[model samples]
Target: MNITPSLKKVIGLCLPLLFSISAIAQPVRPKANWQNLDLQADGMFGISTEKAYNELLKDKKPVPVIVAVLDGGVDINHEDLKNVIWVNTKEIAGNGIDDDHNGYADDVNGWNFLGSKKGNVEFDNLEITRILKKDWYKYAYADTTKLSKDELAKYHQQQKLSRELNDKLEDARKNLDLYTKVKTVYERVFKKIGKQEPTLEDFADFIPDNPMEAQVKMVTMRELPKAKNFKEFYAQSIIDPIKFCNEEINYHLNLDYDSRDIVGDDYNNSNEHYYGNPTVNGPTTTHGTHVAGIIGASRDNGIGVKGVANNVQIMSVNCVPNGDERDKDIANAIRYAVDNGAKVINMSFGRPYCTDKAVVDEAIKYAMSKDVLLVHAAGNDNEDLDKKANYPTPFYNDGGHADAWLTVGASGFRDDQTLKADFSNYGKQTVDVFAPGIKINSTVPGSAYVEYGGTSMASPVVAGLAALIRSYYPKLTAVQVKEIIIASVVKVNHNVDIERKGKIKHIAFADLCRTGGIVNAYQALKLAESRAN
Candidate 1:
C-alpha cells in the first residue's frame, strides 16, 4: 500500500515519533508485538487478548458485539474483513427506497457522513482555518478601547490562529521551492557522474566549468554522502517536499474552498440530520480500514493478522475526512451508531478546535444514557490534554465527564526508555490509559497491509478489547466494562523519561495518565469473572 504524502503529514504530525517504512528496516523481537501477546509469568505489558480467547473463550458460547469504526471510511470488501462486515437485515441492498424507513436509503452496512449526493469530500480546511477565514476582523485587528472580556478573549484566539496559519504556509512554500531546485541539481549531477547511485568521491573528482553546473555539483556534493543511493536522496529531497507543498496549496491555505458544500447539510444547524450517502468507503479507505481490522478482522482466516475480538461485527461510520472532522457530523455519527445498535464506538479523529462542541457533548451523553462505550484517541500531539483541548472529548459543559468514555494514550512495546509513544498526548486527569500504537501492522484499502502508528491505532486496540470483554462476559454494562479495564491496568511503579519542550524529563509513569498502567485484557477478564461470581 502506497502511503500518500498528505496522509504522512496528517498521521505524522499527530504522532511525534512515527516509524516510517523507509526508516526502520530491521524488525524488533517477536515479543515486541505487544498488541497481540498476553502477559507471561515474566512482567510484560500487553492486553492478552489472544491468550484469553484460547484459554477462556474457546469453549464458551461468545456473544457477538457490534463495534463502530467512526472515521474516514472502511473498505467493506477487504479480503480479511469481508465476512466480518456488519450486514443490515432490515434494509435491502441497492433498493432505491428506505427499506427500514430510518431516513437513510439503502444503508445496508453503514452511513457516510463525509459524502453527499454529488460525491465524497476528500480534503478540507481545519475548523480553526474556517474561523480565521470567516471572522478575521473580529480578532485580527481589534481596538482595545472598548472591548468586553469575552470579546478580548476571542480576539486573542483569532490572532493566534492567523499567525500560525500564515507562518505554516510561508514555511511550506519556501521548502517546496528549495526542494524542487535541489532535486533538479541532484538529478543533473547524477547523470554527469554516469552512475545510477553517485558518491561524494565521484563529485570531488569531476570539475564544473559554468555557474549552473557548479550549483548542481555543490548541492549534490553535500547531499549524496547522506544517502546510500539515489532513490533515498530523491525521496527525501523531492517526494517529501512536494507532498507538503501540495497539502498547503490545495487545502490548508485554500480559504475560498469548502468541502462541506458537497454534503448539502445545514452546517449551522446541529439538529439537522439525515443527509449523507450510503457509500461508506469514500475516496480513501486506508485510515478507516486499518482501524476496523484492528478491532475485529476475522480470526484464523489465513490471510491477514487477527483482530482483538474473535466474535464481533464491524459497523463502518464515515464522519472523518482527510482534514478535520466537523463537530456536527461527529455528533450525528455517534447518535446514528448508538441508535443502530453499536455497543462500542471508536473515534480515531479529532482537532484542536470545534465549532459546536455542545452538540457533540450532548451526543456523548446520549450514548452514555444508552449504555454505549466510547473509546477515543488521545491525539498525536505530545502535549498535556488537561491544558489543551482535543475536541469530541467526554468533558461536558455541565462540569462532569462521561463515565463510559475512555481517552487512550499511545504506548510502545518496550518498557524501558521508549515505553510511551513520543507523539502521544498525556494527561494526569484527561487521559485514562495507554495501549500499543507503534509500528502497528494492519489492513489497508486494497488486499494489502502496512505499518502505521499513532494514537489512532491505540484507540482501536482498546475498542477491540472492549468488544472482547463484552463478548465473553455478556452481562457487563458499559460503565462497568470501562472501570474493569482501568482497574485491571498493569501499573508502572517507576519513573520514566519523556520528551517535553525539547528536553528529556524523568517523571513518574503514574503522572502521565490517570491510570499509570497499560490496558491488560487477561487481567480485565480475571476481574470480570470475579465480579460475576
Candidate 2:
C-alpha cells in the first residue's frame, strides 16, 4: 500500500496514480525482463545488462558488494531474494543482546527504525499533516498584520496544503463509494449470469435483466478486453483502489492517528537514533521486495526475474512507511547502512516536504564520508525539481551537494519521443540520469513477480549498476563511480514530450537530465574497467 511522492499529488483524483490498469493489461514490453535488454539488439531502451554480462563480465569474478535497500520493508524469505539477502555475520540471530555491540540487537539482516518491542509502525501521517498538526494551534488564529513575512508565508502554505489534503480525502471517499457500488453491481451480475469468471465474449452473450446489470454489462464489455479476466480486472481496478482510499482516510491524512507510540522513541530529539528493533520486514513488504529484486535478486536461481547485479548482497533497511517517511528514521537508516559496510544505498522513497532537512543532510554527509554512494528517485510528480524541491536531495542547506549522490529519473522502454516516462520528474541540473523504470518486472512477496512504474523503480536500476561497477572495480571511489556512470550514459539526441504545469512541451531529451542520456550498464562498466586499468 505504499505510494510514490508523485502519486500523492493525484492519487485521489483517479485510480492508483502509479500505474494505470489499462497500462498494466497491455505492457510496453512483451517480456517482463526487457529492462535488461539492449536498445540496438532488442529495440528497447534497457541498460544493456545481458550484453555487459556476456561480453565483458563472462569470466571476471565479482567481489560481493553490499547494496542497502532503504524502503518500507523487504521479504527476506522470498525465494528469489533469500539467497542474496545480507547477513550480519557478527550478530547472532534471535538474541536479545547486541552481540556486535552496534546498539542494534539481533540485526541479522538490517534494522527497522519504525518498530519497537511493542510493534512496527504500519501507517503514519504525511509530512504536511504532521506539520499542520504541530503548528496549526500556533498560527490558525494569529493576527496576520503582526506576523513576519516568513511566518505569514508558512501560514499560507499550511492553509493551502490543508485545503488540498481535505479535498483529496473527500475525493477518496467519493471514489471509494463509486468503486464499491461498481464492485457490487459486477458481483450481482456475475452471480446472476452463473459465471465464476466472465470473459468479454461471455458478457456479450448474456442479456441484462435490470438497469444495474445493464450498466455492469456495458462496463465489463468495455474493460474486460483490457484485462485477462473479470477477476483480475476487479482486483486491480476495484480492490486495490479501495485499499488505497481506506489507507488515506485512516492514516496518511488523519491528524489524530499517530504510530510513533509503537516506536517509543524521543520524537523531539533529532539525534536519538539507537531505539528501533531488528524487524526489517515490517507489516508490508511489497514495495521494498520489488525494489530489492530490481537491485540484486538471485540471478542464477533459474526462477523469477534476474536482478541487474549478480554479485551483490542486499541489506534491507526498513524506514519508509505507507505514508511519508520521517526525517529522523531516514537519517538513522543512512547511518546504519553506512556503519554496516553498505557501499551503495538505494533510496526508492521520497516526499515533497521535509520537517528536518538538516538532520538528513548531516546523515548524507556521513555516508559520503564513509565512501557510500546514494542513489535516489528524482520523484514521480513530472515536475522540474529545480523549481520544486524534493526531500533527501543531495544539495545541503549550507551550499554544496554530495558528490556520491545520484538522482535518477524514470525512462520508458522505447527509444523515441516517449523514452522518458510521462510521470518521471526531471531537471537539467537536479536529475543525474534516467533508467529503465516503466513496466519493470521485479520480485514481490511470496515468490511472485509484478510490474511497477515510477522513479522509485528507476533508482534501483542505477544502484544495481553502481554495485556492479563497484563489485568489479573495488578501488573506484563512490564519487568516481558516480562520475563514471554519468559520463558513460547512452545519450538521447532526439526530442521528447514532457508535461509542464498543465500542457505538454516538446523538448530535447538531453534538456531533461544532467547527462541528457539514460544509464547504460555496459558503457559504465567499460568506463570503470578503463579507469581501473
Candidate 3:
C-alpha cells in the first residue's frame, strides 16, 4: 500500500500527539482499555498482563523480585505504590550514619544522585554543552595545521555543538515570546467571554474590535478546539511551553551553570560513590513514580491501575535531572542498583550525546557480569536509532554491546497499519521489541494518577514483565530472560505507516524492530516456564 501526500501529512501530525501528555489526555476513543486488553483476542495490542495474571499464574506462588527504577526519582509515599517500594533490611532508616556500611547513610529506600550533602541539583546542561564549555579555550583559537586527529575531531564537535546550542537558544526565546503573547490574549478574550469554559462557538460569536483582540480570537478559535476545555487549552498551549522555555533558557543552554557545585562531588571521578543523600523522591517525582507504577504498582489493591508485576519490589535509584543526566551519576546509579540485588533495571532516560560514555559502558558491563537485566527506552525522537545514536545505548563504548540489555520502542493501542507509536524510535538492531506507550495510565506525584505517553512509559512495561518472569522462574539467567522476551513477541503481521524523513512511509511492522512484534507478558511467561529450571 502506498501513502498519499495528504495522508503522510496527517500521519506526521498524528504521530507527535502520542508524545504530548496533554494531547493524549483526552483520546478519540472513549472507554479505552486498549493498554490492558489482550491483543490476539481484543485487537488492542497490549502486553496481556491481566490475562497472564488471571489464567497463567493463577495458582502459582510468585517469589518476590526486586526491579530497579533508575530515573529522576520515585514517589515512595504514593498511595498505590508505598507498599511495593523496596526497603533495605540491612541498613537502618534515619540513623544519620551508614549502619550497613554501604557508603550511604540513612538510605531506607534508595539514594538520590541528583542531591548531595549540601542540596538538590534542579537543572543541568547537556553533556555536549558541558564538554564544549570545558574545552572552549583550547578550541576557540585552534591552529588546524598543528592539530592532531583527536584534537581536530574535538574542534569539529565543539563547532557543531556551538551551532546547535545557538539555534536551540534562539528557538526557545521565540517560543517564549509567542507563548507569552498568546497567553495574554487568551486571558483577555476569556475575560470578555465571561464563562469558565468557552467553546469554539463562543469565540466565533465574540466580536473583537481591537487588533490585539483580533489576533487572540484568531489563534484561540483555531487551536482551542483541539483541547477538551479552557483549562486544558491554557495549560497545554500557554503554561507548559512557557515553563519549557524557561528551563531551556535558564538551565539547559546555560553553559556557566554548574550543578556539581551543589552536588559537591568531583563528577570526573567515576569512583566517587558516596556523595548523595537519602531523598529518593526529590522535588519532582512524577516521571520516576509513573515509571515505577507501571512496573510494580500493587495488583489487587483496588486503589489504582495494576502494574505488570504483582510480586515485584521497586528499588528507586535517582540520577536524572530536569535537563540531562550526567554519565557519572548514571554509572553509579546502575552500579548501586546491581550491588543492592536488582535483577532488572529500568532506565527510562536518554540524551543525544554523552561526555563519559566509557564510564557508563563500564557500569553496564558490571551489571551484565552480575547477571542483571537492563531495560532501556528507545527514546521519543521518532528517528531510527540504528542510523542515529541515542546515548546510554546497547552499544558499549569500549568494544561490544551489553548482551542482557533490551532496548524497547513504544507501541500504540491500535493494531492497524499505524500500530507503532508515532513518537517511537524504531531500529531493526537497536530496539528489541515494542510495548504499550500511548495514553498510558499510571501513578504520578502527590498521591495522584495521570496518563503519560513516552518511550519512558513503554520501558517499565517490559521491565515489569521481566520481573514477573524472574519471580516465577527464579533460576533463569538474565540472558535467558532477555531471549524469552525477544523470542516470544506477538508479531505484527502487517504493513504499518511510520514517520520517516518527515513523511509517512508504508513498511512492514516486522522490519521496524528485530523482534518484529510487541512484547507479550503471557507469551513471555509461557516461554520462561518451559525453560524454567
Best by lDDT: 2
- Poorest stretch of ten by lDDT in candidate 3: 4-13
| Highest TM-score against the true fold, candidate | 2
lDDT of each: 0.78, 0.84, 0.80
By TM-score, the better pick of 1 and 3 is 3
Q: Could you give the candidate ranking by TM-score, starting with the highest?
A: 2, 3, 1
Q: Give candidate 1's TM-score.
A: 0.85
Kindly give the number of clashing pairs for every candidate: 3, 0, 0
CA lDDT for candidate 3: 0.80
Error of 1 at 302 (Å): 1.0
Q: Write the per-residue lDDT of candidate 3 for residues 1-533, one digit (tens) a residue.
A: 12111111111111223123223323354124356579767767788888887889999999999999998788998998999999999888877989888888888888898887688877788676787789989998999889999999988988998998888788778767866876777677778889756888898999997998886677666556544455655654566667777777887788888777888888778878888899999865778898999898887888888898988889999898877788999999999999988999999888778878888898999999999999998887778988988789878756788999999998877777667777678899788999988667788888887666678888999999999999999999999999999999999899877765655688999888899999998988999989884
Off by over 4 Å in 1: 1-33, 39-45, 137-153, 174-245
lDDT of 1 by residue, 297-330 (tens): 8888887877988888999989887677888899
The TM-score between candidate 2 and the true structure equals 0.91
Question: Higher-lDDT candidate among 1 and 2?
Answer: 2
How does residue 225 of candidate 1 score in lDDT? 48
- Compute each candidate's TM-score over C-alphas: 0.85, 0.91, 0.89
